[model samples]
Target: MPTPNPAALDFLQTRRSRPAKTLCAPVPDRATLEMLLTTAARTPDHGKLEPWRFIVLGKGAMPRLAKIAEERGQALDLEAEQIAKGRAQFDQGHLAVAVIEVQRPSPKIPALEQTYSAGAVCLALLNAALAAGWGANWLSGWPSHDRGFMQAALGLEDHERIAGLIHIGTETSAPPERPRPDISTITEWVET
Candidate 1:
């Protein structure tokens, strides 16, 4: 029989993402963040390609990225609200990890699988931070998707894109539980 881990199951069941805006200072130090990143890097990679990498964005980098967001937003002619929404996280972030998806050529694993691996890394990092007693939220906005902004701010190459920017810091307040999807409505059991 498989060993049961009730505590792990409970934590997963109750896991909630802290809002990025609610995250505050006193973020994880380098050692702790390294541990979290190590945990996150254990995510499954079909081809052992390790198609994702992390970019640690300290508090000092936030304002710079926010400035880039502003310029890119203006260049794209984004509405004021849209631009603000995109820039808000960087403006307020204490610390974050940018999960970059670096697509690697693989014969057995397809590009879609590589993308999935990158996405999994994002969630893994987010969960790792939360599990380590830090408030964490996975976020992506227009700035993240903007090619020019990513290249200028993160020095990303053509094959690399921002999978997510995971904000991690102390939680100011616990957010109320939101409605969850009904498993019965979303699940389908098949026997063939």
Candidate 2:
């Protein structure tokens, strides 16, 4: 029989992402963040090709990125509300890890699998942060998707893109539980 880990199972069942705006200062220190990243890097890669990299954006970097977001939004002719929504994450972020999806040329593994690996890394990192007692939220906005904004703010290469920006900080308040999807409706059991 497989050994059961009730705590891990329980945590997964109850885990909730803290809102980025509700996250405050006192973000994880370098050592703690490093440990979390180490944990996140253990995500499954089909071809053993680590097709993701992390860029740690400290508090000092937020303002600079915020400015870039504002400029890029204006240049794109985005409405004020949309621009503000895009900039809000950076403006409020205490610390974030930018998960960059670096598409590696692989013969055995397809590009789509590599992209899936990158996405898994993002979720792993977010879960790792939350498990380590930090408030964490995964965010991607118009700025993250806009090529010009990405190039100016993060220097992403042609083969790389932003998978997610995981904001980590102390929780100012616990978010109330929201509605959850009905698993019965979403799940399908198959016997072939």
Candidate 3:
């Protein structure tokens, strides 16, 4: 027999990400945000490499980041719409945690596992925020993928890259639930 956590399972099934644009003011305070980050840091890491870190972008940093996005977009010869789209997340974000994947020198553990661990941290942070009653969304736009943008915005090292930006804020509206994927289509079981 196996012990079951019905509530946790139910929450996972019902979890939905709120749109970044729809999140409003009164974001989580520093102490609260720290708790979420702590929860996120608990994600599994092979060999304890801990190849990730978090950069918390507060309200004051948004404008600067948005400007950087615009400048980077221009430098990259990106279209106007793409530039706006890149800037919009920062423009509307109250607070966001930039989950940075920091690749470490490891002979035993592969780099891909570190990346997967970083991604897991991002999701853990998002879920932590949501569970704490804050509306949250994980976003990564073209700017996040641009090396120049990463350097300009956060002074990331060559080995560091953005895994995600998990935005957390007050919920302005309850978004309607969207369709979910059927487990049968995505899951496979093997007995060998």
Candidate 4:
């Protein structure tokens, strides 16, 4: 007999990520955010190597980051619209946690596994925020991938990369339910 957790399943099915642009004030406080972070940190780590970290951007830091994004875009000769796209999240962001993938050298655990762990952290954080009754969205822009941008914008080292920028705040509008993938087509039942 299957013991069904209706509440958990309902939440999983109904959950929708609010767009970063749609997130506004009433961001989670430090105590609440810390709880969410704690939940996120519970993600699996192969070889027990916690190859990731989080950098929470404070209240006033967002505007500065937005400016830096704009400057970096101009320096990289990106068009104005593209530069604006890079800066938009910061300009309107209420709160953001940057999931930093810290690659630790290991003979047994490959870097890909560590990368997967970092990605798992990102999802954990997103789900935690949503479960905590806050609107959250995971994001990664061109600036996250550009070495100069990551360094100047976030002071990331060579071994560290941005896994995600999770935006958390109150949602201004309810988002429509988007279509999901057909799981039967993707899943394979192997009973040998």
CA lDDT of every candidate: 0.95, 0.94, 0.95, 0.93
As a whole number from 0 to 100, the lDDT of residue 112 in candidate 4 is: 98
| Candidate 3 accuracy as lDDT | 0.95
Q: Which regions of candidate 4 are displaced past 4 Å?
A: none
Question: What value does the lDDT take at residue 175 in candidate 4?
Answer: 93
1-192 in candidate 3: lDDT tens per residue? 999999889889899999999998999988999899999999998799999999999999999999999999999899999999999999998899999999999999899999999999999999999989999999999999999999999999999999999999999998999988899999999988
Expressed as tens digits, the lDDT of each residue in 1-192 for candidate 4 is 999999989998888899999999999999999999999999998999999999998659999999999999999999999999999989999899999999999999999999999999999999999988999999999888888888988999999999999999999998998999999999999999
Select the stronger candidate by lDDT from 1 and 4: 1
Which segments of candidate 3 are over 4 A away from where they belong?
A: none
TM-score of 2: 0.98
lDDT of 2 at 168: 97
Model 4 lDDT on a 0 to 1 scale: 0.93
Residue pairs clashing, model 3: none
lDDT tens per residue, model 2, 1-192 = 999999999999999999999999899999999999999999998778999999999999999999999999999999999999999999999999999999999889998998899999999999999999999999998999999987999999999999999999999999999999999999999999
Q: Cα lDDT for residue 112, model 1?
A: 95
TM-scores for candidates 1 onward, in order: 0.98, 0.98, 0.98, 0.95
- lDDT by residue (1-192, candidate 1, tens digit) is 999999889989999999999999899999999999999999997778999999999999999999999989999999999999988999999999999999998888999999999999999999999888999999999998999999999999999999999999999999999999999999999999
Q: Count the backbone clashes (under 3 Å) in each candidate.
A: 0, 0, 0, 0
Screening candidate 1 with a backbone cut-off below 3 angstroms (N, C-alpha, C), the clashing residue pairs are none
Task: Give the residue spans of candidate 2 off by over 4 A.
Answer: none
